[model samples]
Each structure stands twice: as C-alpha cells, then as structure tokens.
Target: MIDGLVGGRLYGEAQIRTGQNGKRFVTCKVRATTNDGDTIFVNVIAFDDEVQTALLALSDADSVALSGALTPKVWTDKNGLIKPAVDMVAHKVLVGYRGES
Candidate 1:
C-alpha cells in the first residue's frame, strides 16, 4: 500500500457501523476529481475513534483531506462487467478543510 492524501468533497453522511466481530468503524465517501476532469468515488474507512469524531462533525458540503494508505478494489457490476476502484483506509483525516463551504 502506498501513502497518499485524497482531497475532495464529502459525498454523504459518514456512516458508523459495527463489524461482525463487534469493532466499530466509520466510513465516508469522497468524490475526487481526476486529472481528466472526470470523477471517481473513493470510500475511506477510519478505525480510530479520534478520527471518527472529526469526521462525524463534517457535512457533505465540506472539503476533506484523507491521509492514509491506498487500496485497490474490484467488483462485478450488474452487467457482469468487472470494475476496478481505489479506496483508502485513512489513519488521519482533516475535516472541514475549507474554512467554509
């Protein structure tokens, strides 16, 4: 995994869920713009309570910065087409990055 920062607007409300093993985690989706002017969505997960608290206070309008390790993901579409994507497991997150948005 490579370290990176993903900056973009929060896509929706950050969700807090408990894993089957009883560990709580937070997840947020970010809509990052590509160099080609297109958009790719990334789902960032935070297992740290401090980071989760920070993410909980931010709104979807906020510009966020996620510092973490990049991960690759693959899924099969409804049409049975294989698609690839990138996700980040954020160790640190800077929420409400923009003063106001």
Candidate 2:
C-alpha cells in the first residue's frame, strides 16, 4: 500500500551483481526533489533483465519516473551493527530525455 512520487536524477549508474541463485541483479540510486524543496534519495532494484538493462543505460543526470511500493529492509552488519534501509520496488519506469515535454 506504499505509494508516492518517485522520480529524479540518477545519483549513480546502475550496478549489476550476481545473486545467490546466479541470476543478475541491478541496483541504482536516485535523487528526488519534492515540491516542498526537500531533496530525498532512493535506491531502486530491478530483477527483470529488460528492466535492468534499461536502468543501466541511464546516466547520472538522467531523469526517470517510477511508481511502486516502498519496502524497508533491516539487517546486521559483520560487526554486529543493526542497519535499516529502504528501497522502491518499481512497477513502471519512464525515461526523460532533454528538451522533451
């Protein structure tokens, strides 16, 4: 039931890594600015090959729009420190090119 505006510049390029099952996983960070002038950062992960490919093509300044659920993850680091994190499970992605209305 998590929903909100999720779109912004690619803070960094998408990185592909191998998962436990040997499948490829892609992850990236986005910097979004809200109407209230609040800037927020979000991490996005894509499991689908096509989606992953599309995400990787985006440059650092590229704009993208996505709609999806926000899921929080909690874990303990090797040093036994507890960490909490959150990311978006994108259902749609729209690439914005320069000068495009």
Candidate 3:
C-alpha cells in the first residue's frame, strides 16, 4: 500500500453504507487530473468518524484533498483501453472552499 495525498473534484455524492458486521462507512469517487492532462479516478473509503462526516457534507464536483493508503489499479474502458486508477482508504479529508464568499 502506498501512502500519499490526492486532490481532486468529487465525481459523485458520497454514500453511507453499513457492513455485515453492523459498521457504517463512507465511500466516494474522485476524478483527479494528471499533469499530462489525463484523468484518473480514485475510489475512496473512509471509516473514521471525522473523515466520514467531512465526506458526507460534500457534493459532486466539490474539490477535496485526502491523505491515506493508495492502491494502484487498472480498468478497461468502453473502448477496451486500459486506464489507471487508485483506491484510497482515506484517513484525512480536506474540502476546498473555492468560489465561496
């Protein structure tokens, strides 16, 4: 597992779900742009109470930065092209206040 920080815009609204063990957690996707203009999606999950609360307050397209464990992944697109992605177990969440007065 790679520990890193990723900043991006929320791809969709975060979801809260319960596990079979009766534990609740949050999950969300972030669309991050590469320096070369490519877009990579990060699947994020947070179990910490603070992180979960911060994610739940965010909306789609909201800017956020997260720090935690990252796992590299690859997925095939509709055109059969393989794209890279990351799965993050986020421990910290930072929501950007851009465009807010």
Candidate 4:
C-alpha cells in the first residue's frame, strides 16, 4: 500500500452505492495527466460516510487530492475484453485545492 498525494481532475459523477453487506460507498475516476501528455485514470473509492460526503461535493470540473491505498485491478470490460487498471481507496479526499506541493 503506497501513501502519497496524487492530484487529478474528476472525470465523472461520483456515485454512492451500497455493498452486498449494506455498507455505503462512493466510486469515481480521476484523470491524471502525465508529463508525457498521456492520461491515466485512477479509480478512487471512499468507503466511509464522511469521506463519501466530502467526495460527493465536487463535480467533473474540480481537481482533487487523494490520500490512501493505491493498488491494481483487473476486470472484464463492456466488450468482455480483459483489462488491467489502477485503483485507490481514499481515506481522505480534498477538492478545489491546487496541489500546492
């Protein structure tokens, strides 16, 4: 688990959904632009209500700073194609703030 501040822009509407066990959480994608001009989408999740509340305040135009666990994920896409992706479970999320570091 890596802990660092990664800055990115919200790519879509973050949705709050309930898990099988009835726990609520939020999920969305943050698009980070690399120095090479390529974009990387990081799937960000917040499993707690307070964090969820914070994440849901912003929209696609806002930038965010994410802090938590970063990991890789693999799943089948709409075309049934196997894809590999990166994800982060955010314990904290800050919006409308420039990455001042």
Candidate 5:
C-alpha cells in the first residue's frame, strides 16, 4: 500500500487522466500530518476503470479515505534521467464532505 496522504494537508483533489491508448488512471496527492504537526506528501494512483471514474468525480478539498496496495514504477525520462514512482492500487474508497464528522 499506497494508503498515505500527500500535499500540505489531509485535503486535496485526485486527478484523472487517459493515455493516448485509452488507458485510464487516477492520481491523488494528499498531505498527511503527524501528531507533532509535521507533514508528508504521498501520491496515490488507481488504474481500474471503475475506480478511476469514482475518483475522478471527487472534487478538490474533498475528504476521502482509500485503501490500496503499493506499486513501484520506474521509467526513463526524455532528458535521459531515470524516474521512480510509487502509486496505490485502490480497492476501497470512502468519500465524505468537509466537517462530516
């Protein structure tokens, strides 16, 4: 799992994109805060079509809970640099509005 948060806070938006080959993918960057107020950034990705559509419907600043596995992807960039990416394969998703608690 890629079940962590990214950005500067717990709230953020997920981005969905379709490749030229018609492959769909969803990415979410969330900001996770530690108990001490420290923050970490995480990037989550969903490749399943159904999950992608669901994630795409989520708007910015929405609160979402996701469960998934972690996957590492590596590729070479056009500048001849190797890039490594870690993503999540979301299996469960819960969407909630702000202050829903």
Candidate 6:
C-alpha cells in the first residue's frame, strides 16, 4: 500500500453502496494519464463522510484529485490488452470550482 495523490477525470458517476454491516460508502473510477502517455484507471472508494459527499456530487468526466492509499494493479481489457490500474482508499477529494464567479 502506498500513500499518494492522484488527479484525473471521473470515468463515471459515483455510486453509493451499503456494506454488509449497513454502512454506506461511495465508489468511483478515475482515468488518469501516466507519464508515458498511457491511461491508468483508479478505482476509488471513500468511507469518510466529506470525501463521500464530494465524490457523489460530481458527474462523469469531472476533474478530480484524490489523496489516499493506492494499490497498483493490472487489468485485461476485452481485447486482451493488459492495462495498468490502481485501487484507492480515498481520504480526501478535491473538485473543481462549481460556483458562479
């Protein structure tokens, strides 16, 4: 597990799910660009109330930055292409300004 920050656009609208213990959490996917010009997907889950609220308010493709625990992973696409990915236990969520000037 690595502690770091990731910035990207939300791949889809965030979803809320209830745990087996009846606890609710938010989950979302972020598509980040790698240094090598590749795309890396990050699966983010937020348990904190503030983080969850921030994530739930954003729409698909919204710019976002998150800080938390990151776990590197590899996933295979439908075409059998291997892609890099990460699982993030997000503790903080940063969103772009939404209010009018």
**Please, what is the whole-model Cα lDDT of each candidate in the order they appear?**
0.85, 0.78, 0.96, 0.82, 0.62, 0.95
Clashes of each: 0, 0, 0, 0, 7, 0
**Alpha-carbon shift of residue 8 in model 5 (angstroms):** 10
List candidate 4 stretches off by more than 4 Å: 73-84, 97-101
TM-scores, each model vs. reference: 0.81, 0.74, 0.94, 0.78, 0.58, 0.96
Best by TM-score: 6
Please identify which of the two predictions, 1 or 4, would achieve the higher lDDT against the true structure. Answer: 1
Q: Model 2: C-alpha RMSD to truth?
A: 4.9
Q: Residue 92 deviation, candidate 6, in Å? A: 0.7
Residue-level lDDT of model 3, residues 1-101, one tens digit each, is: 89999999999899999999999999999999999999999999999999999999998999999999999999999999999999999999888655766
Pairs with steric clashes in candidate 6: none
Error of 6 at 48 (Å): 0.3
Error of 5 at 63 (Å): 0.9
Pairs in steric clash, model 2: none
lDDT of 5 at 66: 65
Residue pairs with colliding backbones in model 4 are none
Best by lDDT: 3
The pairs that clash in candidate 5 are 1-69, 1-70, 5-30, 6-30, 6-31, 6-42, 7-30
User: Candidate 5, which segments miss by more than 4 Å at Cα?
Assistant: 1-12, 71-86, 97-101
Q: Report the C-alpha lDDT of model 1 over 1-101, residue by residue, as the tens digit.
A: 98998888888989999999999999988888888876678888999998898888888857888899998787777999786667999998876544566
Which of the two, 3 or 5, has more lDDT?
3
Which pairs in model 1 have colliding backbones?
A: none
Off by over 4 Å in 6: none
